[model samples]
Target: MTFSIVARSADGRLHGVAVASKFLAAGALVPAAEAEVGAVATQAHVNLAYRSQGLALLRTGVAPADVVAGLTAADPGRDERQLGVVGSTGDGATWTGSFCHPWAGGQAGDGWAAQGNILVGPQVIDAMRDAWLDGSELPFPQRLLTALRAGDRAGGDRRGRQSAGLLVVRRRGGYAGTGDELVDLRVDDHPDPVTELGRLLDTHTMLFGKPDPATLYDLTGPLADEVAALLAAAGHPVGVAGLDGALASWAGVENLEERIVAGRLDPIVLEHLRRTAPPGRTGD
Candidate 1:
């Protein structure tokens, strides 16, 4: 009993999946993706093979449709399976077996494929597709979960909500992480899985995420009022407040660049300071 959104980024450089279900730790079972390959979701008599094989196909230059074809060809029980795939090219597809269960079905579109089984009705898939097209229009993880939330609102996983998970990959680090596996957050078990998933994603994006390096700076000379004003304008009060502390804490340090790099302040805050201050006030 689950609902899932498998998608590739509009620009075709990223791939991700978000899934929620009445099952325990849905994230552990439902989603898989790689930055250079694509994404896959296997649910409703879920087969783990789809995870490795599907990605291998996409990595080997197979299209989404062909990946499904090849996968189904090898799995005689394909008709009883609910699956979704997105290729590196952004091609998407879904399959819902006629014998799946009541209220079971799915939809495929431009860059995403949404599907669910043992739900309230086709509305599950319908709401997912609509939300994907009409939601916040943010990046992949946000958009994908928005679609999943829509399905949850429509009555997801006939068994009820227990867990949710999100996976995203890109060529470079996302708002968090040091590599292409941008977001791999999951709510293994929750009474309100969708809400929990959203909360987790929001928190993950804001706090633990890596800040832009270009915003790092050096604070030389006396603190400038213009610097505070600039930092305020650019949305960083931390840097403005911490300039004196950074200099004082790091005995005799004049440049913000060295202070920031030496762990005197938050990198993101330092980066903001570098950007907002006038030229040469800090390294950009």
Candidate 2:
């Protein structure tokens, strides 16, 4: 009915899960994670208790296998459950109940566990693992989504796709300069939810992402000359305007590093601005 990947990031500061299912909005039932703790996915006769209980156990230093055992032991319907877990140390574990639907089984490895039940044979899970291993260079959420896409391509959800979800978190928001959740996006129900999820993530990044340190603009020359050119080029028409205008101009078309790397703006232009822009406050 569903396939999911639970993983701990290489830097050990993130934990997340990506899942898609034909079981209505799978996001509401599957995929749970806590920053710096671990992640869990429960499906195929899912025991909802596993969500909070699994996080609690991981928070208390419990191992992935132990968490699985504890959750299963408390569930009367354990024989119909399919579950996967990845602990903070990258330890991975999975379980497929003996009484789960057709084509029910799973595979587990060092950093991830892939599982699904009903239809599509074991290739669904296999393709998910293979995609993750192949996409190792991508970010954790991207890697997880890549795996989900692979399973979907390999004939996912013995039933069909109805909902998809992605959850990720780190010590800090990793942007917006806060100690809050980093990534919290979900597609509760949609004919093409994965695509929608990606769109939302992109929008979130544009608004919340802070400029990378390597991209931060630093100056080394006269502020007057630099401000003058920036104002002229921006069609500000009005020279230097004010402190707000100067700072806003500083964060111009190419002043942000991510934009430069993304080819959305010219890197040389950003570099020049960094070397000459003035110091001041700015806001949206």
Who wins the TM-score comparison? 2
Mark the 10 consecutive residues where model 1 has the least summed lDDT: 250-259
**lDDT of every model, 2 decimals:** 0.76, 0.75
Q: Give the per-residue lDDT digits (tens) of candidate 1, residues 1-284.
A: 88899988877888899999888998999899988688999998898999999999989989888888888889988888989999877559888776787778878877789988889888888888888988647766789888888889988887888999999888876532357878888888889989988998876664445435565444443434444444544434435447454333332232223223333245544444555455543323
Task: Put down candidate 2 lDDT per residue, 1-284, tens digits, no spaces.
Answer: 88888887787788888888887778888988888888899998888889899999999999898988999988889999999988888568999999999898888888678888885888898899899889979977777888888888898877777888888878775554365467777788888777787787776665455555565344334543454455445444334455334434545544343333222233344445545444341110
TM-score of 1: 0.76
Could you tell me how far off, in angstroms, the CA of residue 119 lies in candidate 2 after the best superposition? 3.9
Name the lDDT of candidate 2. Answer: 0.75
RMSD of 2: 6.6
- The estimated TM-scores of all candidates read 0.76, 0.77
18: Cα error in model 2, Å: 0.3
Clashes of 1: 5
Which regions of candidate 1 deviate over 4 angstroms?
A: 174-177, 210-284
- List pairs with backbone clashes in candidate 1: 215-271, 216-271, 218-256, 218-257, 219-256
Per-residue error (Å), model 1, residue 1: 0.6
